[model samples]
Target: MAEGDGVVKSAGRVLGLLQVFAEHRRPMRVSEIAQAMGIPQSSTSMLLKTLTAMGYVSFDAEAKAFRPTLRVALLGAWLNEEFATEGSVDEMMVEMARATADAVILAVENGVWSEYIHVVQSEQDLRYALRPGTKRPLPATNLGRVLLAAKPDDEIERIVRRINAEAAAGDRRFDVATTLDAVHAIRRDGYSFAHNLISSGASVIALPMPVPPGYKPMAIGIGGPTDRLERGQEMILAEMRRLLSQYLGG
Candidate 1:
């Protein structure tokens, strides 16, 4: 094979090693990665050591296994989105925060959950306690559901099945069929609103917002007590649509 071909093959091996750490957050030994990825143990050990040298993996002395470092899994995405959107999303999120006065958040789908990237505080004493890296289930929050609604049917089915399996394993609370129906409803509705559905006396409305090409998508949310954003739903969505258009257009 050519030099370029060899480089691509090496990259594929490195990425495969990276994926072996993604099934869960725990570390795995070289023998485990070899079996999981169908690569040879000799190659897996060498590749893992290479990744460790690159600051992407660590051989945990206590666990006696290779684990991905925060730096290793960091972009773990297709590519960086910051450069793609040119930073206009920050302004749009702030605009939503100012317009609603309820908590306006920017989030993205992380597995079957939504991860907050930014959050604007609500004036009400009651607020959802979520940090930037916090992960909330798709069925529990409007933000997570809107993202699930945007996914293709097959992807949606897979997520639903995983939810059910987790529920059966006693890790979650809802069935797959009900969750799939909810995702479909959110897609048809274009936005979703629910009050006290997941938490008592807490209300949240979220709409999936578009982003520029080459950028990962986001959602805008207005959350507070049931009465707070109820009156402003239509207005908030309309403003979100406008801001999305402006950022993606120019």
Candidate 2:
């Protein structure tokens, strides 16, 4: 393999390892981390040892578990002042989740996919478990469509075509014209909503978040069962709008 390819692969594994800790929010054994990352235990142990030596991760001998150190949290803490303040995106997501009793997700465009960077699980018993690091095709999800709405038509079409070109035969393919129409609707309406488009009996309502300069485009979404989301659409939209205006001033 090329040296650059190896570097990128290693970087992705480090980020994925950090994300596993973020998802579980607890110290994890080597076996647990390996299983979560779908990597070999030996590799996981080596990675953990490297991180420990770098002072980015800590290992507890008594518990035989590893956890990210404060240095890891400090790495990106200065990137966004808003994130360090009271009226943060994190706070808004929590409020939205509480108000709607549904899953709230913060997604960012990652290559041709929309990746959920943060997810507040629904309080409702019947809801699905949407975890952080979940990814979906950029042109095929409401959350993704809202992120795409921030881009120009030409870029959207290019991205759609690329997604189609790379997709396997059995995988879903996107129609450029159809995707453009959907993105246009999202732009006109200032939000996107879809029911049962990606998952059966599931609905998602999403709006583009105000991205800071030099930051990737992002969208915040609320998701739940179709019937419940449909019934509470108005209320949910109102809450979302209020929170966005209050916290993000958008």
Candidate 3:
């Protein structure tokens, strides 16, 4: 591999290592992390040592494990602040939850995946329950399609092809043509809605949120059972627009 390409690959691995900690939410032994990530033990040890020196990970000498430091949480704090007038994403989530009366979430594109950064559960008994930091392919739901619709067609096609190939390898069924059609619809309508796409009897409606000029695009969405969400689709979309306009000045 070329030197530059190698550097990029290494950087991605480092980020992936950090994400493992975020997802697992616990300290892990070097061998455990290596096994989980399929990285060689020696290489994982060296990487952890470097990360420790950089203050991004902390070593627990007593437990012989490593965990992510507060520094990792602070990394994305500024990006969240950029979207809020008072710099509190929680405030926005709270408002969206109250207005939508369903699960409200904030998500962004992570490669060809949609990563939920924040979530507020619905008060209703029959609502979709999605945890924060959940990552899924962009074509799986409207929460992802809203962000993907903003990308150029060529880039969208590439992401779709890669996602489908991965799905095929896993023996999962995915329709690329249908996903492309949904992308085009999202592009035209400036929002997206999906019913029973991510889970049985669940539905989602999402729209892109306005951010500062150079910030990566992020979306706010609401999810609930298909019967309730489909019944209230118009009202939910209207409330989402109003919420975005009120707080974000979009």
Best by the lDDT measure: 2
Local accuracy of candidate 2 as per-residue lDDT tens digits, 114-193: 99898888867899578787789998899999999988999999999999999998999999999999999988889998
lDDT tens digits, residue span 1-250, model 3: 1124346867866876876674466899999898866778999999999989999999999999999998988887886666666536666677878987998988988888898876778889887887665887887778888888888878878888887777655544457678789989988888888678878898888899887987678888898888888888899988888777767777
- TM-score-wise, the better of 2 and 3 is 2
Backbone clashes, each candidate: 0, 0, 0
TM-score of each: 0.59, 0.83, 0.67
How many Å off is the CA of 152 in candidate 1? 2.7
Off by over 4 Å in 2: 1-9, 82-87
Question: Any residue pairs clashing in model 2, and if so which?
Answer: none
* For every candidate, C-alpha RMSD to the true structure in Å: 11.4, 3.4, 6.5
**Candidate 1: which stretches are off by over 4 Å?**
1-87, 124-129, 167-170, 213-217
Better candidate by lDDT, 1 or 3 = 3
Candidate 3 Cα deviation (angstroms), residue 6: 16
Which candidate tops TM-score? 2
